[model samples]
Target: MTTQEVANRYIELEKQGRWDLIQEELYSDDIVSIEPDSAAAMGMAKTVKGIDAVKAKGKAFNEGVEEMHGGYCTEPIVGGNFFSVAMGMDVTMKGAGRMKMDEICVFEVKDGKIVKEEFFF
Candidate 1:
């Protein structure tokens, strides 16, 4: 698959609420995930390495969400080996209450697999 193909499929699965499947299928084993400095204050690691680590992050995040009101990953803008999407969500956390979250997520793909994902809010 090409970079665009992978990105499009990612958006498709994301819209279907199938993020778990995306990481398993589209991400490289050594993929790196980067969270902003502010996220560390919320208990999220600033940098997460490996696919398993990424999955763990997702699990931890899900465990913190009491309810998901709604969420979305917008269409990606592809360029060379990268693509970017605007994503956001409205959710109530276990103890953090309800809040709206928004960010731009940029992904770097190589050999048809996503290798890095960085977020900017």
Candidate 2:
């Protein structure tokens, strides 16, 4: 799959809310995930390396959520091996109150798999 193909599939799965499938199918084994520095206060590392670590991070995040009200992922804009999308979610956290979180996510694809992902809020 080309970068465009991967981006399209990502958007498709994102719309379906199949995040597990997205990681399982589209992420490279050595994928790297980067979060903003402020995420450290939320108990998230600034950078997570490898697919397993990334999966664990996602699992932890989902576990921390009390309730999910809604979420959205905009259409991806692909350039070279990179694609970006604006994503947002409205959710209630376990300890924190309900909030709306919005971020721009950029993904880098190599060999038809996502090699890296970085988020900015």
Query: Residue-wise lDDT of candidate 1 within 31-119, one digit each (tens)?
Result: 99999999998999999999999999999999999999998888999999999999999999998999999999999999989999999
What lDDT does model 1 reach? 0.95
Q: After TM-score superposition, what is the CA distance of residue 53 in candidate 2 from its true location, in Å? A: 0.3
Q: Estimate each model's TM-score.
A: 0.98, 0.99
Q: Where is the poorest 10-residue window by lDDT in model 2?
A: 11-20
lDDT for 11 in candidate 2 is: 98
Candidate 1 deviant stretches above 4 angstroms: none
lDDT of 2: 0.97
State the displacement of the C-alpha of residue 92, model 2, in Å, after optimal TM-score superposition: 0.3
